[model samples]
Target: MSLDIGDALRSGIDDLTGEDGLLVGSVFLLYSLGSLVADESLSAELLTLVFESGAYTAEQRAMVDSFGGSPFALGVGLPAAVVLVVLVALAGELVRYWAIRSFAGPAETETDAFGDRAVMAVGLGGAVALTTLLFQSVLPVVGQLGGVATTLVGSIVGPLAGLVLLTVFVYLRQEIALNDGGYGETVRNSFARFMDDPASIVILLVVLGLFGLVGGLPSLVAGLAGGDAAVAGLPVTVLTRLLSTVLGAVFQTLGIAVVTDAYLQVRTSARESAA
Candidate 1:
């Protein structure tokens, strides 16, 4: 009982354009802020590292030293970074919410399961943040220590592992969004559903990977373009960042809908097979 990947993608697109635009819009705004802040923090860290590496003379070092300790740059933008994490979490949550509504039918009342959804959002967001932190901090150190083989293995394994984990998350999130379920119920249902029809996991990963690849082009172009011409480059980079964020939101919503649709179809197929 194979899932209808094409139909799921079509439904996903329709959901984003029709019913889920506002949710996707909010996701874009939140994701853009997070991306911008994360970039700024990374730039500050790089500048500091360059200064500390003694690549420059004392005067030159002094010039670059300013990059190390601005209010926003210092401690990696502190409260703003914290806020960005929350925003990222929200972005993750809204996509799932939109998907659940589209697939399972919208909530009958505005107040329906808001609290539970918040819990699910926080959980998903925490997982997202943790995954990122490990990729940023742990992976590099491990790569350096393990050399080329380790780096190569990680490059292959990391994304595959992340994809698997993400599907699990999606499974749980679907229950949280669609069912009036507790954490326990969500966990059980997600695991049960996936175990019953494992192929949908692949479907989800492929769909998300394709969409993410397409969505990431703007950021790639932005980073590649924009030479030292600060006047030309700044606006171009800024616009591209904005565009990337918007694309990100679009795909996030689309991914959720696609996965949910896959899940629903898979569930039906599995049930029919059992019958």
Candidate 2:
């Protein structure tokens, strides 16, 4: 498959320009909200509650507390995290949509919502679930290896897990397209070609890495500033989590968009090759 970096970037821009901003915004809002609950800042409280309520033993709580994240993140912090995520997603989508549109034309209005959501759920959800599972299984070994060793293992394992997840995601997405009156086998075939063409996969990963970098910079900067400071109460903890969620949701969307577009591009390319 031929690589066209310029085209991809331009297409992502066009896709965003053509999107129903209101719809996208609404989705972002919901995503941001959900993310708030998922973030570490807010989740700590929930986890604490669970631990305090006897859901887990004191030893488990100790392990969790030992991880040493921001304790100041509570209620407000959580919302900030949510907004951060939403904003990042907004930025990522702005570029991604344009890039996609440059190549694919306007996304189909009739199928847009369902198609997007389906891809998001399957692609993102699958990756997260798989990664979490793998991470959990590896934790024992990681702990035995110590912090440095665990971190090293995580560095290698995370990307490998992503590759596996993407492969599974492509297959499922193709099935959706084919049977759901969606995009059809185009995605499936393209994914196969991308897999065969290592360069294309490398380019895709590079693009995704760029996206991650863009999405991560703000939070990293915040953490550096004062985000790491500890808060005194549950309310603050909840806020912090909310903020983390919003930020996570936004960045997560970027990831979701990249996966979706790549799958679609692969499908399109495969069809052209077949033709």
Candidate 3:
């Protein structure tokens, strides 16, 4: 039997409820909030440095310095900020492993596998981070070296390539969580799985992307209206950030559940065919 995209979506919705759903949701919430704090803290530090450099006029310096006093400003060193971000990312991946296992079914979701899974999650997360950094770092350089024509092409191709990589890594995470394979094997299998049914994966990705865009509208509007400005006694930017964080967490959980269910269906079909 081929994959039924609608059925997979329905299954995902079902998986994203009850105790397991709450567990996943909570972890994602913390993960998103941690990320937000880390990002704002780093931004604050950068702004403070720029203001103190004496490049800006006194008025500009004073304005930026005032922002340095905001609650998000941590005065953390770059090394410490990076470590905090890495820790948050690892925590996110750990919960992702648990969510995938739970969605896969009870037999695959073994309590004793925590230690092994944590190690695997670290490997998987690191690989993904490296892959993303490589693409980001390399693509811009490649574009620069080639001149305006190449830069234009890169502008279009870069995002498409990034999306494809994102899809592949999402499957890679599923593979790692569901199987007891080494890093290399998991990576190969994820690519192979995508090759087997790229259309479905792309379709699912588009659907999820649309959902994310819709969910982010409130934040977008808030930013456009005035990100730094206050609205009715509340900080619009902070409020929007919190709203976006919550919405992002919910959508991320749903997306993972959907992908996990879809992967299971494909794997089951492949097994039956082989049998």
Candidate 4:
């Protein structure tokens, strides 16, 4: 009943190159671009408002003011920017439902279950967002306690907590897509799956993490460079960001494929053993 990592990876690669995979990749690309625009615009406006209000520390204010204006603007206020970001996120979630079902290999007769699956996807997304928010909300309180031990603990625990949440999320997606389970059942099943084969999950996560790091290099370099150079009168930073966005889309799509394949392998093994 153990996972065959090599077979799963090969199957995943096949899934990623399929026609539906291209659709998933395209949706991810649009989502990435939309999020970048909305997030940058919102961040600039928030910083400007904070700076003008002098609510931040003097040092923080000075650094932000040095930008000479907003780092990015879309002529939209914070409220509008928030709405745009939410819309983009919702769109992505809807498309992701289809992608997940496609990966799960539903029968043609099950096409009518789209509404149910879509609702489950949205519910799952909301639950994850709330969980993440709650987790992050604890960090400031820990920081305010103000001790080196607390800081060290937070640094170590934070990444581990994030990784656990991510693992749960990945398996939960597959469970919801492939099984007729509600939120609670899916959550429990995902946890059980992790407990049953933690090593396989860890290996899959490490592989994905390496791929993500490679995909993110362009963006990291551009950020470190501070975007000082221009090529053909276009900023190198812009070009790098564009390249990073594309790579991110590809990486995300591949991750989804690989995880889905791995989940199916585990599920099939369990079923055969039961039989």
Candidate 5:
């Protein structure tokens, strides 16, 4: 029951164009901000490395630094973070919706799982934060734990946790539909589905790899260029930083889209086979 990759992508694109899809995209955009906030330390470090190393000009560095230690920064960052979280959530929902639509083949389901949607958005937002923290702090400490097991567990846990979260969302959606249930039921179903699909569990890593390849590279290059421009002149640096920030957002959005779409495809095919 392998699916056509092209059809799957087309369905996802079509979904992305609807009013609900736009809402989903908007939510994902918000949700992505949560990811950005969670990864602030990493973002900061990366920016510093890129800018200070002649990737950007001193003026550009100064502008980014201006937000430092400002109370208003929180006000600005919070809204942005919320938006990012919503974006990720919406993207995930779109994928799941498409997966269901694709598997069921033209059968329409009620888009009424508000509880499940809320739980998914909040849960995923938390997961994003936790995953960010784990990578930033836990993994480094794990490296110092001085054992192969500890190192290996530390290395894999965060990503695996993320994969599990993704699977849970998919599982919960289906289970809730089947059981006439809500959030708690969906959560339980998510755990069960993850356990049932080790192969698809591994598929997450592949999906993420592809995400980095397609969605990450453009921004990486953009950052490099922006950083270089920033170091060269003040005006150029300012523009460069601004452009790079937008570029980062775009890349993040696209990355989520790719991951959501691909994971949905995998989940849909697997579910059809199981049935």
Candidate 6:
């Protein structure tokens, strides 16, 4: 199947840039909140929350509080971060659904509402998160089997595994938005679609990765240069972040829209070929 990469790219950009500011603003807000919630700052309340959750005994919790909450405590911190990630993902899925439905002329609405799609988002996020944890958990075992070649390969394997899992997540999440099925049904159906044209999954990941790399360049350079760029006596980090945030918002909004249209087109072609 020949995908008109240029046409898809142009249409996606037009749809995203043609929208009002609200979509961009919403994306920025979600990304920003995710960064904020992931911060490691801890407080007495956080200490109680963390310790109270059984990271430590009751006596330990009390003792930790006696140190003026210490400079380090995170009761519920990790849990809160996890919840926030799910929330951000849910928000992204809602954006994807609303954008695809309105912009792509899907003309179908089986599971269109945000509430209906929440389970799908959680499932996607959970799958990705679990893939991460599972890979991390196996590192010790990998380490123990250490030969030089084995250790060398193991070092990059986790990240490579993550990248592949993420590609799967990207494809499946778009299906969840476009297909309008329950989580299990979505997974089964989407996997079948994936099997039909696995190349499409690779294409999706490459396009999305290019978008990310393009959007992230300035920040990337700054980080490599030590996060201290300046423009007109203003901190470069501030300006880079602002620019990156805007681009990230635009990239995500367009990425889903473009992929949704492409997915529909691909599925239609597959059915025709099958017949």
The Cα local distance difference test for each model comes to 0.59, 0.46, 0.70, 0.68, 0.46, 0.57
TM-score of 1: 0.69
lDDT for 206 (candidate 3)? 86
lDDT of 4 by residue, 218-239 (tens): 7667655555655687666677
Instruction: Name the candidate, 1 or 4, with the larger TM-score value.
Output: 4
lDDT of 6 by residue, 97-138 (tens): 556655555464356465666566556745665566435433
Regions more than 4 Å wrong, model 5: 2-6, 18-23, 30-38, 41-184, 191-212, 222-228, 231-275
lDDT of 3 by residue, 1-275 (tens): 35678987888888778677778888888888887787566555544554555445798556544432334546687568656656766777777887788777767443456576678777776667545633543354345445568666665677667666787766787887787777788888778777667788788888888888866776667646654567787876667667878888888888999898888877777767789
Order the candidates by TM-score, highest first: 3, 4, 1, 6, 2, 5
Evaluated against the true structure, the overall lDDT of model 4 is 0.68
lDDT comparing candidate 1 with the true structure: 0.59
lDDT of 5 by residue, 181-252 (tens): 455665664555545554654454455456445544534454455433434444343443344444444444
Per lDDT, the best of the predicted structures is: 3
Candidate 4 local lDDT, residue 214: 80
2 versus 6: better TM-score goes to: 6
State how far residue 60 of model 3 sits from its true place (Å). 13
RMSD of each: 5.6, 8.5, 5.0, 4.2, 8.4, 8.7
Residue-level lDDT for 239 in candidate 5:
44
lDDT of 1 by residue, 1-275 (tens): 45666787787777667745556556556655665566455545544554555545798555443222222333454355545555655565655565465555654223355565766656754565457544553354344335568766555666556655666655666666666556677677677777765775666577578878876786566545532223443544555556766777667666766777766776677657789
lDDT at position 120, candidate 3: 78
Residue 56 in model 3: lDDT: 56
Q: How close is candidate 4 to the true structure, as a TM-score?
A: 0.79
Task: Rate residue 254 of model 5 by lDDT.
Answer: 39
lDDT of 3: 0.70
| TM-score for each model | 0.69, 0.53, 0.79, 0.79, 0.48, 0.65
| Model 1 stretches astray by more than 4 angstroms | 39-87, 107-111, 136-138, 141-160, 229-235, 269-275
